[model samples]
Target: MATETASREPRTKTRTTASPTVGAAVVKRTRTVAVRLTDAEEAAWIAAALVDGHRQLGAWVRERAVAGYLGKVRPKAGGGGLSPEDAAEVAALRQEMTKWGNNLNQVAKAINSGQVPPVMAEHLEKGWLNRCGQALARMADRLDALDDQG
Candidate 1:
């Protein structure tokens, strides 16, 4: 009887990701795509990116491109960005503060000119100035909180 030998091939190692989330895989963006934009076009994109609170234009562009390619809407930037309600509140607070600043400046100018503004006198008599101070303090607290979040 003759003996026969079995041939075997070397096995290669395979790698896989052990991600906890099912059906979710992290992909590295390694490819670079150069885009040419005019000054106006770049400005427009930068403005849009700022509105979306994106500090990096390249990251914003990549997100927009991928969203467009997938036919999905680009969501707002999450980290360090305010929600819609908070943004609205901040805008209102800014407008209110502007008005208060203008009133204070007018009062100061009147006082320096050796004349008391009637509105200032009225606010003082009605104790409205105290109320305004309280409001400003509250606004300052809220703004401080918002700044911390950002």
Candidate 2:
């Protein structure tokens, strides 16, 4: 024998999403991917995705998901029209991203472990995430604008 609970509610079917004016619309999904992760790899990816205040992950994942979507990457050696100032700025952005990644991881651990006290890590984490997101978006746009494919 089986038992069921009844609710006074109407059921509805889902409809499709609308397309954008300028570009084609994409359907959102909830499909799952299967991967075999060892302890080390799991830990590493978590660190990577959550690092630096959970800001860079979006950009990082986007870049990986769509090749060349962020536009031209740095020029190779012997590449011409490469300005030193631009190169230096890009390098600095990378460094900034790294710093943010580390800070994010620290904050995540604090929140997870319920330890690392004397520190309300969430506030700083949120601030850094906002800063990193702005910086990342700008840098990606700049890189795209340069069209610096080498």
Highest lDDT among the candidates is held by which one? 1
Q: What is the C-alpha lDDT of each candidate?
A: 0.64, 0.50
On TM-score, the candidate that comes out on top is 1
Clashing pairs in 1: none
Decoy 1 TM-score against native: 0.46
Residue-wise C-alpha lDDT for candidate 2, range 105-147, written one tens digit per residue? 8877887898856545556645756776787788778766654
RMSD values, in order shown: 21.5, 14.4
Number of backbone-clashing residue pairs for each candidate, in the order shown:
0, 3
What count of clashes does model 1 give? 0
User: In candidate 1, what residue range of length 10 has the lowest lDDT sum?
Assistant: 11-20
Error of 2 at 74 (Å): 16
lDDT of 1 by residue, 8-50 (tens): 5322432234212446675443344567676456555665664
Q: Please give the TM-score that candidate 2 achieves against the real structure.
A: 0.37
